[model samples]
Target: MCEEQTVSLVDVLEEDEELEEEASAVLGGSDSDSCSYPQGYVKRQALYACNTCTPQGGEAAGVCLACSYKCHEGHDLYELYTKRNFRCDCGNRKFSGLQCKLYHEKDAVNSQNKYNHNFFGVYCTCRRPYPDPDDQVEDEMIQCVVCEDWLHGRHLGRVVPDCVELQEMICESCMNKNPFLWTYAAHLAGPEVLVEERRDESCANVPKKAEVDDVIEPSCKRSREEVEPSCRLKVLQASQQKRDQSGAVFWPSAWRSKLCSCITCQAQLSAAGLSFLLDELDTVLAYENKGKSSEQVHQGHDPLMSALDNLNRVQQLEIIHGYNDMKTELKDFLQTFAAEGKVVTSEDIRHFFEQQSRKRRRVDAGPFYCS
Candidate 1:
């Protein structure tokens, strides 16, 4: 977001000649020279009329630079430039609904507030415009995927780790508006998982080439380009289309604006065991985890245990039973040693494993059992 700046009529009059030429070209043989400021008023500069202020059918209306400053101060005014040589219609009968308050056309408007990001000269946390005339810094600016507004890297407060062309960046404002978007951004920004390596003495016996491969190779790797794509844009567009078709008034405008079906958001929802439909009228209804049971389970269980419980139920049962069986045998063994007044050292445990291997070789039938 940027603070509104007061624009002086003198500054508006001195707009570059190139802009005027472009506007003249756009008008194409329309008598550009014929249009001038009202009689006895010196024509200082040419300017494009505010499309919003122009009567619905008269969108092509143009205004002089002074008239634009006087009448359409807060309006979204387009710059047509000097070549178009247009006069102000702000005081004309066509715009009788809106009266010009500035008597001296050269003076500045009191409150030149701008509502949309399009009118902003600068944006983001830094609040500096692109190609800042005063500052010669040449850093690249990134456009927010959601707002489609440009922002500086420093303002975003993070280095863009991936190639921008391949991935879209959602602004912080957008993320704050939606929990799903926040999760998606956090997931993207989180540190990557690294493969663990065994540095035990036994690993020394492994072949040098194989050992090198084991150390360098990651358990899983994904390229930055692969991670970020136009999928989010496509999902947003589809969601918007669906909303337009539904014509449902139940959905809040704010929620509708934040609606997204990006892969990251979908994956996050899936990880949380949530199922949802994009076109559903009620987002709360589409979400599967809304029930009190899920909420209770989430809040009551330890996070670690809850995560483990998410594994296959059969595997979970096997792990519990296996641990119990191992515990029983270990207790029995310890009791036997206590009765004999003998302490079981580390060597004894190593020997027992060696003996078990030898027994396995001799039997050559059933699986080896250590007792």
Candidate 2:
């Protein structure tokens, strides 16, 4: 009996090892079965957000790699992860607000290319996107408050007394157009001015007649030169605050006007309008997809399409879906499992799917149905 038990245990161990190998094969298999891209079609680069261009409703959107180099060169760009199996949408009627400068036969340009900045990557007095180390100037480059372009210290000239004192510096062109920008000073003297006012208040109790005379005519008057700096500083501070709040770093220019009408902006505006209409028109008739052909409409739409539309409408109404809840739960489970640093096996995936299926079945079954 003891020998038989030992042989059975060995056989059970061998079966377990085989099952483990099979599970590994199922979970860590090659993805050759996945869809393949066409030959000669090069993979597109990652998406990038153009800080220079503003989308409709003031939200920012990502542009294609070509758009970033061609149109948004020298403009602030934030890179996003590469999206697989997608074409470049820069200069398209949905992503870019301006025409494509580098648009060619290879580019996917449409009616969206309305206005182009004709950006050639040359900017500032140095005429380069970045400072050339060959020049060997130690002065730091400052961004122009108006044009939003980085200007070398030499280009700004004597306008900026010291680069250290520069918080927000306006370009020469902007200052030339609006001379008032030149007079902006720092508002650091506010505390000092308040201290002087407090000192004046201490002398208010001296004599009634003296106090009245002091109120009518100040003991000391600040000269135009002394007061101008403080006034300019206050103005500058106010302007900076306003700009920061509005998220507008660039100076207002004609380029902005052209950008506002770009394809990206038009698409955004259309989407927003449609969303507004959908919300306003909550009737069943308005819920139908307008893009459907007469035959498709007559044939009765796919249940999946109707379900998705209903889900969107319900979400708009602030109603949560069970599927979304299930997704969140699954996401949390996967995250937690990954965090534990354990190798997830096919068993884990199968178990998760089984649990979700059971839950779905329970939901599909009426509440009155028993075990």
Best by lDDT: 1
Clashing pairs in 1: none
Q: What is candidate 1's lDDT per residue for 185-209, written digit by digit as tens?
A: 2212222111132222221222243
**C-alpha displacement of 116 in model 2, angstroms?**
11
Candidate 1 accuracy as TM-score: 0.26
Write candidate 2's Cα lDDT for 184-284 as tens digits: 21111011112112233221222233422233233224454443322222333344422111111122112111122335444543554322211322211
- In angstroms, the error of model 1 at 107 is 30
Off by over 4 Å in 2: 1-118, 121-144, 150-179, 188-321, 334-371
| Model 1: CA > 4 A from native | 1-115, 186-371
Clashing pairs in 2: 97-262, 146-251, 185-232, 185-233
- lDDT score for residue 82 of model 1: 29
Ten residues in sequence with the least summed lDDT for candidate 2: 184-193
